[model samples]
Target chain A: MDDRSFVAAQDFLLSSKTFWTKQIYEDLKRTYEDAVARSGKTPTTPADVAAILEGDTLYRYFAWLERHLQRLKYAGRYGLVPYHDERRSVLAPPLRDTGAELSPTLEMPSYYRRVDIHQHPGGVMSDELDGYVYERGARSTTPLMGASHADLHHRFTDLVAAQDAERVLYGRILDMGCGFGKSTQPFHEAYPDARIDAIDLSGPCLALAAHQAPSRSSPKVRFRQMNACATDYEPDSFDLVTSTMLVHELPPGEIEKLFAEAARILAPGGRMVHLDFHAIDGPFARFMHYGHGLRNNEPFMQPWAEMDIHASLSDKGFTNIKVIPFQEAEGVDLENHAAWRFPWTVIQAELKTGG
Target chain B: MRISDSLILDRPEQNFFADPALDRAFGVVMALATEVYVQRDRVRALERKLEAAGIIDRADMDREPSEDERQANAEDREAFVEGLMINLLGKQQAKGAS
Candidate 1:
C-alpha cells in the first residue's frame, strides 16, 4: 500500500477501540487459553499463566496483540501532550558525578526486571520468535520497519559515499539490546567487514536473533545475553555501537550507565547511534508523548525524553553528540518533507578527541 | 458473588492509547482469561485423569455451574468487555492525535 493508504489504515485501526475490545481481546484470551491447556497446567494467577507460556512463540502472540492495541491507541491520540515530562520529580535529571562505579547489586524493579515480560510472547520485543511479530506488526501498521530498512540502507550508503567515511567499512560493531536483530542485521549488510555482536538480557530473544541472522549470510553475527549497562567486552573494542527503541525502556540512572558503558566500549573516533523518540518542538506533540509514557507503562520514557542526553554523553567524555529527528518509516528529517510519519528520532554521538 | 451486583473494572490513571503498563495489563488479562477458559475445558477432558489420580472425588466432580454463578460470570465478562472498550477508545483518541 502507498503511504497515504497505510496512514489511513493506521488511523482507522487506532480510532476503532470497541471493535478491538470485543474481537481482538477475546481472540487473544481464547488463544492464550488454548496454549495453556496444551501446556497441561492450570494456573491460579495471571503471573502463573504468563509463566506457563513464557517463550518466544507466546511472546510473539502477545506482541501481536500489543501492536494492534498500540496502533489503535496511537491513531486516536496523535500529538496530544509532551511525549516526555522532564519537570516531574521522578524524571528529574540525574546526578552528574555518579562516577564509574558499577553497582553489582543494582537490579531492576521486580515489575521491570524480568526478561519475560519485557520480551512478551508474540511481541516486537520477543526476538526468539524471529521477526515474525516485528515484521508483521510493522506491516500491519504502515510499513514503518520496511521503510526504516530502506532508509537505513540509504543513509549508510550516503554516509559511505562521503569522503573520509572509511570507518563505516570495518571494525567490531555492537548493538545493545538488539531485540531480534532487526537493527543489527542491517549494519552487517551495510558494512560487510564489521564483526557484529548483538546483546540483550533475554535468552529467547537472542536465540531468535541468532537463528534469523544466518539467512542474511552476513558472517553469522553473534548474539549474546548481556545487560546494556555492563558488558563482557573489553574497553575501546567497538568502532560502532547502536541501539533501537531501548533507552526509553531504561530509567535515567540506567541511561547514564549506558552512556558510560558505550564510552568504555567504543574505540577512539567511534560513533554510537540510538534510534528512539524525541521531544517534538510543539506542545501538542509533547503532550502526546507524556500521555503515551504514562498510559503505556513506559515508566522511564518520560525521564529519558527530558534528559539532556547530549550533556550526559559529554560528561561521559563523548563529543559531537546530536539528537536527529528522523522519520519512523524513512528515517528522514520530518521537517524537510512534512510526511505524516511516526515521531521517532535517532541520537548519534562520538568520543571526543583527547578525552 | 451476587449476580445482581455490577462489577466495574476501572483504570483511573490509565491512558488507553499510549500507556504500555495498561497495555501490558490488558495483555496479561487476555492471557489469563484465555488460560482460564482453556483450563475449564481441560478439566472436562481430564475427568478420567482426575479420577485415576484422585485429585477430585469422581461423584462430586459432576456438579454443574449454579444459575447465580453463571449469571455472575456473564456479568463479569460483560463488565470486563465494557471497561476494555472504554480503555480502547481512550487509546484510539490518543493514537489519532499522534
Candidate 2:
C-alpha cells in the first residue's frame, strides 16, 4: 500500500483510540466506581479492582483495546514491521560497522536478549532496522501525547536543568538506556557544554543514535553499548545520571542494581532523575496498568509499580528522594484526567555527601 | 532458537475472557473495528480520486465537517459501544480474583 493509505489507516485507528480514551473510558470508570461503591470496599490492589471490574463489559473492551489496538498499530497491514522490512537496504546504512563512531562489537546482555519487550516482535537489539521500527512505534505509543510528544524530552530536560542549571552543564551526563538517542538528544541540545555518555544494550540503536545526531562543529554525545546495571565508568565520575522509561523495562533486582550503579557513578551531591510510569491513583487504575503489563508483554511494569522506590533509594544512600506525577504536555492535567495516559512520574534523588 | 526464527509464529495475546461466547463476542467487535479502518482507507482513496479527476475542488474536499457530521461521529462511537455492550455484558463471570 502507498504511504497515503498507511497514514490514513493509522490516523483512523488513532481516532478510534481517542474515542476509546475520551468516551468509552469514562463509561468504564464510572461503572467501576459504581461497582466499588456498592461493594463497600475500596480496592487496595490490582487484584481487588480486577475482582470487581474484570467481568464488566466496558472494562473488558477498554483492556482489549489497550492491548490489541497497539498490536494492530505496529503489526497491522501497513504496520511498522512490514513497512520497514520493505526498506531494509535504505535503513541499513546507519548500522554499518564504521570506524568507531559506534561500538566496535555488540555485547548484548543475556537479560537484555530475553523478552520482546513491548511486543516489538524481535527486541530492539536483534534486528538491523529495529531502531527505525522502535522510533515509528514510539510515535503512537501514547496517542494522547499528540504533537507534544516531542516536548516530553525537552520538558524533562528543563526539570533536570531546574535542579542546578549552571552546575548541571559542562559536567558528565549519563543517559541510561538511551534508545535511538531520543532521550539523549534533548540533553545534548539543552546543555551544549555538557559531555554526554549515552548507553544501551543495542548496537543498532546506538548506531542510529550516532547517525541521527544533528550536524555540529563537533559531536557532544557519545552513544555506547553498555548495560545500565553494570557500567565501566570510574566511581564518582558523573554529575548527573538519568533515564527515561528505562527502569520499568528492567526487573526489580536490575532496577536496584542500576540505582546502586547510579550512586557509584555520581559525584557527591550529584543528582539522578528518571521519568517512568508509577503514579497510579487507585486500584482500578492499577488493575488496568498491571493488565497492560501482561497484555503488552512487559512483565516488570507491575513489579515496578508495586515497588517501594523511596525505601530502595534510601537504602542506596540517596537523599531528597521524590516520586511525583509529571505533566507531560500543557493542559493535560496529571490529576483527574479521565482518558488513558501513561502514569508519568519523575523519580529524582541526590547522592548523599561524604557518606 | 532465536526469537526471529520462523519456528515461533505467534507470541502471547489477550485471552482474559474465559467464556468462549464472551471471547467470540470480543473478537467480533475487534473485527468490526478492523473493517471500519479498512473502509476509512477506501473513503480516503475515493476522495483522492475525486480530487484528481477535477470533479471536486480542493476547497470542496477540504470543507470542515458540519455540526451534523460532528454529532454523527460522536453518536456512532456511542452507539457502537452501546450495541457491543448488549452482546458482551451479563455473559462474563467475575472470577480469578486471586
Per-residue CA lDDT of model 1 for A1-355, tens digit only, reads 1223334434444333334434544554566568667978666543564454434353444344544355332221220011111122322222112121223344434434432222223232322232333433333333234344546534643443242366453478888987656667667766667788888765544555665565235554677667888888898788778887788888788889989999998888887888777746553335435544644456666678788987899898898888877544434556642322335777888886566
- TM-score to true structure, per model: 0.53, 0.84
The stretch of ten residues in a row with the least summed lDDT in candidate 2 chain A is: A97-106
Best by DockQ: 2
Chain B TM-score of predicted candidate 2 relative to the true chain B: 0.46
Among all windows of ten consecutive residues in candidate 1 chain A, which has the lowest summed lDDT? A77-86
DockQ of 2: 0.13
Docking class of 1: incorrect
**Model 2, which residues run further than 4 Å from truth?**
A97-107, A167-170, A215-217, B1-13, B20-39, B55-98
What's the chain B TM-score of candidate 1? Answer: 0.33
Task: DockQ for every model, please.
Answer: 0.03, 0.13
